[model samples]
Target: MSVSLDPVNIADKLSLIDELWTQRKIAGLNDYEIKLAKLKGEFVWHTHPETDELFVVVSGRLTIRLREGDVVLGPGELYVVPRGVEHCPVAEEETAVMLVEPVGTLNTGDTGGPMTRAAEPL
Candidate 1:
């Protein structure tokens, strides 16, 4: 007998990078989006006005910083930045993270600083 299969998983199909990668999409009734980001080094500081953002560390370590304080997240750790809050992200080494936020949300929020925005995937 022969069998056929789709042979692909949606969750695994979408990767934003060829090596180090990220994946994202708008989801939920509130138009929130889900994102998967992989990183190393430091990211620009920024904020989001209309929505809060949630990050979950899937592998390695992630550091989240704010003007007032900072937090480090390791595997299975999670963090949330309230709407209109300013924050930054950094990874000492390679790290994988998942982010959730509303659709049309700006990666940089109001700052518009360099690295403020992410280009929509083609």
Candidate 2:
């Protein structure tokens, strides 16, 4: 297999995204995929039973709300939602985030509804 030596520019990739809550796959590492998403408003409460989800804030703020509490992240910060833990992601304003999860993992997790989307290549 071939690998890219050039950097994957986050800002450039994020610029290609027009819709909120849509994830764009930027790179892949092993069995995990690196994705970028623009988010606003609240997402559905869901859980990934098979893998943990990593959320890294690129711009603005994000809150990962859980039954236990809420984990807030700012630009350059990140949070990991443990597997099988129910959580909802909320962003007051337009937020740019990077998600690291297993390839083929759905954004909506256990609750598959309208918000669910397959991450397409950037």
Candidate 3:
């Protein structure tokens, strides 16, 4: 397989996504995957036992609710949920976010539900 050297525009990729809470893969790095998703409400509470999950806010606001406390982020900000930590992300309005995690990491982590989805390539 050949790798494309072209740039992945975050805005352009996000614009193509129509469903909320569904992540679409944009690129890969080593064994990790970079994905984009639009969020409009609350996500399921879950935990990733082996890998830390990264969340970068591209637009709007996101509040990651944890057992300890809530971490809020706005555009251009980011927060990493440590491995084994339970977290649920909430967005009051439409929000765009970038997620970085190991390839094949399920969005729902340990909690498998209807909201769980495999990140598909854009």
lDDT scores in order: 0.71, 0.96, 0.97
Candidate 3 structure quality by residue, lDDT tens digits, 1-122: 99787998999999899999999999989999999999998999999999999999999999999999999999999999999999999999999999999999999999999999999999
Q: What tens-digit string does per-residue lDDT give for candidate 2 at 29-85?
A: 999999999999999999999999999999999999999999999999999999999
Best by lDDT: 3
The candidate, 1 or 2, that scores higher on TM-score is 2
**Best-to-worst ranking by lDDT:** 3, 2, 1
Better of 2 and 3 by lDDT: 3
- 87: Cα error in model 1, Å: 0.8
Which regions of candidate 3 are displaced past 4 Å? 1-3
Q: TM-score for each prediction?
A: 0.75, 0.97, 0.97
Ranking by TM-score: 2, 3, 1
Candidate 1 lDDT, tens digit per residue, 26-58? 233356666666678887787887778898897
What is the clash count of model 1? Answer: 2
Model 3 collision count: 0
Query: Residue 104 lDDT in model 2?
Result: 98
